[model samples]
Target chain A: MKARVTITLKPGVLDPQGKAIEHALDNLGFSGVEAARAGKVIELDLADGTSDADIDAMCRKLLANTVIENYRIERL
Target chain B: MKARVTITLKPGVLDPQGKAIEHALDNLGFSGVEAARAGKVIELDLADGTSDADIDAMCRKLLANTVIENYRIERL
Candidate 1:
């Protein structure tokens, strides 16, 4: 089974990297890009029996910073 | 309009960051995770007139590292 984890900054959290990316786009002449965010994706090939609870545990324990980020787990 | 770009390491490319993440998972005792990948997601809030070609240009010019990474753009 495959699982995909998407981690994004929590609402109201400061994202300097995102701001930097927005600026880079502006320099590249993409001034129409109003706002931008930079996040991370983690793909995992897991054992067949891996449960949703197990994946959730993995996110909370290591994959994401709960205080500043929110992660969604998708099983494929 | 919103656009999403997912940038992932090209196959056979060196991904030290991904490997490091895998190792970290191992240390956290997630032995069932067979293979893992680390990638980037860029979310953009763009002007309504932004065309697919313009978004593609952004990826080619600034958003993605074309040599080691492949990026997919989704408009929403």
Candidate 2:
């Protein structure tokens, strides 16, 4: 089984990295880019029968920094 | 309008950062982990009525590295 976990900063959190990327894009002549926020994606290949609850636990425990990010898990 | 673009490495590409993170997780005693692939998420705040095709073009032109990554756009 495979799962994809996406971790994104919560709204109102400062994202200096994303801001830097946005500036880079503007310098590259990519216009009309209003704002940018960057996050992370983590893909996991796990044993079959890995429950959703277990995956959620994984996100809360290790995959996501709940202090500043939210995570969503998708099973494939 | 807003769009979220997720960029992930193509399968078979080496992901050293993900490997390092996996090792860190293991060191933290989070077990049952198999493999980890890391990627990026970019959120864009755009003008109202930004078309999906335009968003896709942005991904191709500036947001994603087509050589090693694939992107998906979601509107919110």
Candidate 3:
């Protein structure tokens, strides 16, 4: 089984890297961009029968910093 | 308009970070994870009517390292 875990910073969190990207975009003449947020993607190739609960635990325990980020699980 | 660009390392490329994450997951007791590849997600808020072609250009020019990374664009 394959799954994707996306970890995004919650609203109001300070994202310095994101800010830097936004600035770079502006300098690169992509002024149409209003905002930019950078996040992490973890693509997992798992053994068959890995449950959704274990996937969720993976995000909570290590994949995401829960205090500042939220994660979504997508089974593929 | 909203779009997401996912940039992943091409297969066969050396990914030290991915290997590190796999090791960490094993130590954290997630033995079912056969492989883990880390990637980047860039979420963009754009002006209305931002064309798909522009998004593609963004990825090719800045959001991804075309030499080693492949990127997918998702319109949200």
Q: TM-scores, in order shown?
A: 0.95, 0.84, 0.97
Predicted model with the maximum lDDT: 3
Steric collisions counted per model: 0, 0, 0
Displacement of residue B2 (Cα, Å) in model 2 is 1.4
DockQ of predictions, in order shown: 0.85, 0.63, 0.87
Error of 1 at A54 (Å): 1.0
The lDDT of model 3 is 0.92
- Better candidate number, 1 or 3, judged by DockQ: 3
Give a tens-digit lDDT track for model 3, residues A1-76: 9999999999999999889888888898888899999999999999999999999998988889999999999999
Docking class of 2: medium
Chain A TM-score, cand. 2: 0.96
What does DockQ come to for candidate 3?
A: 0.87
Task: List per-prediction Cα lDDT, in the order shown.
Answer: 0.90, 0.85, 0.92
Worst 10 residues of 3 chain B by lDDT: B53-62
lDDT of 3 by residue, B9-60 (tens): 9999988888888999999999998999999999999999888888888888
Candidate 1 per-residue C-alpha lDDT over A2-69 given as tens digits, one digit per residue, 9 for 90 to 100: 99999999988999998998999899888799999999998898989988998999899988999999
Q: Stretches of candidate 3 above 4 Å error? A: none
Q: Which stretches of candidate 2 lie over 4 Å from their true place?
A: A28-30, B26-31
